[model samples]
Target: MSMQLNRKYITIVFTVAIIAFPIIIGFFMLNKVVDPEEIMITKTEVSPELITIQGGFGDSISKYHGYNISHHDHSLFIQIKGSKFPIRGDKDFNISFTNTYGDIAEIYLVGQDNAKRKIWPQP
Candidate 1:
């Protein structure tokens, strides 16, 4: 009876150890450092002026108001041209992207300052 009991105890312990091993290793892997070059873009857009914009190009992001002065409705527009579109200090300003890569180029934006931005897309 004693030998059988010992055998059962050893079997149960080994089974538990086998089940727990991967779980423990997975927990440790959570601390592994993530690569900085990899960015998860939530939104995507295509424009001719953004052909050179690739993954990890955008440094930050800002929102711009639309046609209404009071409505404050805006869209996410990361400026790849190194210029601020919103503060052009005009009400009838139309943002234009022309004379570059066709209007079908995919690009990504990166948000650095508490903003949700995207990357230009992987080359």
Candidate 2:
């Protein structure tokens, strides 16, 4: 009779562990799902024409200037007046431009990487 009770107790313990193991794993998986900081923006696209910039100069320049913008992974490609320029970023960039006589030009730059800010002053 003692042997039968010992076997029953062992079976009950084993069954409870089998059920509880998945529950414990699911609890950890739920934490992983709820974390938003783990999410990343794999790709981003911005149209130069669609962007809004403050100040009178930015508004006037955007209204008259034209640009072609493209981004792939960490690299940026910009084309204007049959010339292309490439830039790479470990984070993000805010780009703007101005055209003088449709020949002479300037590119404004604002960028951030790992929370460090940089601005390439208007030229």
Candidate 3:
């Protein structure tokens, strides 16, 4: 009889742990993800007719005295020009220019990983 009672307690403990472990892990994961720092917005000026970007929507510089805003990411990357660079966390550098249409430019910075993107400044 005592063995049965002990078995019941063990089963109850196991059940509670099985249900609660994931909840606890999820809570910690959420906490870790919710603490991201704010993204920085920097602005610079570039000629609208300086460069032409050639992939994925075909962007280019179309405005004079336009803006070259970017969120520079220094993550591990290569510019496909025999160059490899590190794009660290919180160090992504994607640029977007301001023209008549909006924050889209013709000049693109193609990465070695086949990520073709406009070289405009971030907002």
- Candidate-wise lDDT, in order: 0.36, 0.31, 0.34
lDDT of 2 by residue, 1-123 (tens): 999999999999999999999777754432221111211222222343333222211111111122244444433333211101122111222334432122222222221122211111221
Could you tell me every candidate's TM-score relative to the true structure? 0.30, 0.30, 0.30
Write candidate 3's Cα lDDT for 1-123 as tens digits: 999999999999999999999777654432221111112223334453332222111112111111222323321111312101122122323334233333333333433244544334432
After TM-score superposition, the amount by which residue 40's alpha carbon in candidate 2 deviates from its true location, in angstroms, is 2.1
Summing lDDT over every window of 10 consecutive residues in candidate 2, give the lowest-scoring window. 55-64
Model 1 alpha-carbon miss at residue 73, Å: 34
How does candidate 1 score on lDDT? 0.36
TM-score of 3: 0.30
Predicted candidate 1 versus true structure: per-residue lDDT over 16-66, tens digit per residue: 999999777744443322222333333344453532222221233322232
Clashing residue pairs in candidate 1 (N, C-alpha, C atoms within 3 angstroms): 107-120, 108-119, 108-120, 109-118, 109-119
lDDT of 2 at 111: 18
lDDT score, candidate 3: 0.34
In model 3, which regions exceed 4 Å deviation?
33-123
